[model samples]
Target: MGKGAVAAVFALLVVLVLAVVVVLITQGSVAIPLGEVVRVLTGRGAESEITRTIVLDARLPKVVAGLLAGAALAVGGTQMQTLFRNPLADPFVLGVSSGAVLGAAVVILGTGGVGWLAGLGVVSRLGVTGAAVAGAAAVLLIALGIARRVGDPVVVLVVGVMLGYLAGAIVDMLVYYTDPDRLQALATFTRGSVRNVTWDELQIISIACAVVLGLSVYLAQPLNALLLGERYASSLGVNVRRVHFLSLASVAVLSGITTAYCGAIGFVGLAAPHLARGLLRTADHRLILPASALIGAAIVLVAEYIAGGNGLTRTSLPLNSVTAFVGAPVILWVLLSGRSRKQAR
Candidate 1:
């Protein structure tokens, strides 16, 4: 794509994201006006106290959470696909999200394996974030170790899927033994929902996403070199091992923190990068990373609109259910395109 075309594409995505954010804030159950939503966001007040409460206090935080989670997942997915040289590779595919969820489950399900982690700060935002990052890093390290030992990318992919399954089984066991009261607290973490997050937690997610996302830009050139193969990347003076470590760490932080706050919202990480590549028709990370972030954020916001936790539907639905619709088709297309076979070659 030409510079102008790429710029135009990114510009459209930015405008689309802004428009969607406005729609999400305005179209909830009560259906506040766009003016009121903008007024409240701009430090003015809506005429009705209830309207103000819903827009500012109830929904704004969730929208922000969705935006952050989407961007983070999308960026992580782009990095993983490049790192593993597989279209099917994602944070979810590599079991990074599963690892983070397991860490949070450990805390939520308690050390005794039968109690809640909530006790006047036991389940604080920082605690869960820490546990999640730790878990994601651990799983990432394991996957990388296996990749190093196993020459075949497909073997590594299987190991990652098994890792996710193992982690899920452990989480299920924890849920089974834990008290019912504590289940609600753990529910959002696993099933995925942005509605319950508070502003304080949003701050944590935003800060982490910004810092880690910024660091990822530094990896763009190195990752592009890596696309030509490790030998070529090394010939071009790229440190393959260091790039792998840094990129994996970045993915861990982005995927882990989002999973911790929003639960294991699926498919954003899996689908967003492919969409970016399709739209831009290039694998260059410099262009792909930001484009992926915007698309990811937009996808999540659209999913939230469909899930209708606020007012669109009578009852809330899992964010995953909505995302799977977009995600599953992409998976099938990649498999049938013979992309997997190409990777094996």
Candidate 2:
């Protein structure tokens, strides 16, 4: 697509994201007015303290968390697709998220007592986040090693799926023997939700995501070269091994921090890049990266709204349930339309 078209698409995505943010902030149980939401967001204080508290405390963190998690996952997914030369590669699909969940679960469930992690404040959160990052990195390394030896995208994809299941199985066993009270903390890890993210946790998420996302900008040209093949990328002095290491590390941090806070959100990583590519009509990482981030953020916000942002329902649905509606169809289209096979070869 032309630069103008790309710019227009990005503009529209930004607008969509902003619109969703407003709607989510305003449509919750108490129904704050748009004017008030805007006022509070702009630092003009709301008419009522309760409205201010609800908007700033209750909703803003969720919105910010969604934006960060979506952007991070989308970028990680884009990188994974290019690195593996597989259309289906993503952190969640490749078991990275599940690994992170397992790591966090160990920390949360292995603690001395119920709510141990929660009671310790930011330090404990950091420990869990670090463990999550370690677990994601472990899975990433294993997957990359296998992918290199196997050298088949389809096989790599299958292996990734198996790894995910293995990690999840470990988590299930842990949950089985754990205290029921600690299980509540593990609940979100499986289902996914941004509702519990606090301003402090957002601090860690924002910093880690910011650093990794910035690094992705540097990796973009190298990634684009890898799309042609590792040999071609190496021919162009891309340092294929270094590029692979950096890309995998980036994916680990992005997926790990997101899963740590947001609870193994699926499909946004898998679906958003495809949507961005479909819209941009190109695989240029420079364009695809930012576009994917915007699209991913919008998708998560919309899903959150549908899942319970409206506050009409007493119980919110698991985010994975809402995201599957988008991801499953994309997976089918890729398989049936031969996109996955084409990319595999």
Candidate 3:
């Protein structure tokens, strides 16, 4: 697609996302009307304080978190895919999400406290996010190192899978000795949920998203050059080592933070870039990155709506389940088609 057309489509997607979020806010047991949703959003709703609270205070955070987390993961996935020159590279596949999950589980089960992060205060949330980021960084660093040594993408993917299994094993050991309540708190991390995020955490997410998204934009030129092959990029005067560091570090931070708060919502990082590339008819990072972010945001928001916003079913569906319904198909197609193996060749 032309740049103008791509921009228009992205704009339209954003509008659709906003509409879906509005509809979602008006859903659930209380069922605020569309007019009220608009009014509430506009800060002129005539509804009672309670209704306003439900819409603005309660639902708004979840929706916003879903938007940010989805975008972040998708963009991170795009970067990793490009970095490794592999279509199958994703947050989960790279072991970033698993690493984050392991870190959070260690904190939760070890501390034996209730709720996410196991009764961590704001400072502790930062600590947990840091731990998650460190874990992701560790995995990405190792993966990149292996990618350098290995000629085949399949080998790199297998290495990543082994890393994920190792992290899972550690999490299992932690769960074994932890009390049930703490284990319950850790369970949601594996399941994923935007609803559980706090406004404070939302603030953290927004800041991280803005900073990393901007950085990704700055690095897009270098990333596109990378796809031409490392030697070609080096010939173009791109600092290959620096680019790898910045890209992998940025991906680690984005994936870690999103997983830390939203749980390991899968496939988004893998799927969104493909969708964006398909839509834009190009794999150019400049367009693919932003488009993936917006599409990812839209996907997650819609998924949340389908999963019953705020106990619409008097119970919530885990975000991971809904996402898996969308993501698993993509993964299955990739695996069964043997395209991934072909690409590695």
Top candidate when judged by TM-score against the true structure: 2
lDDT of 2 by residue, 1-345 (tens): 788998899999999999999888889789888898889989987799999999889999999999999999999999998988888998999999999998988898985632566767888888788889999999999999999999999999999999999999999999889879778877888999988999999999999999999999999999999888888988999998898889999999998899888999998889999999999999999999999999889989889999985595788998898988988998887777786576789
Taking all chains together, each candidate's TM-score versus the true structure is 0.94, 0.96, 0.92
Per-residue lDDT over 57-78 for candidate 1, one digit per residue giving the tens place of the 0 to 100 score: 7989999999999999999999
| Each model's lDDT | 0.87, 0.90, 0.84
Ten-residue region with minimum lDDT total, candidate 1: 113-122
Q: Which stretches of candidate 2 lie over 4 Å from their true place?
A: 111-118, 339-345
Ranking by lDDT: 2, 1, 3
Top model number, lDDT: 2
Candidates 1 and 2 compared by TM-score, better number = 2
Model 1 TM-score is 0.94
User: When superposed on Cα atoms, how far off is each prediction in RMSD?
Assistant: 2.4, 2.1, 2.8
lDDT of 3 at 255: 84
Tell me model 1's lDDT, rounded to 2 decimals: 0.87
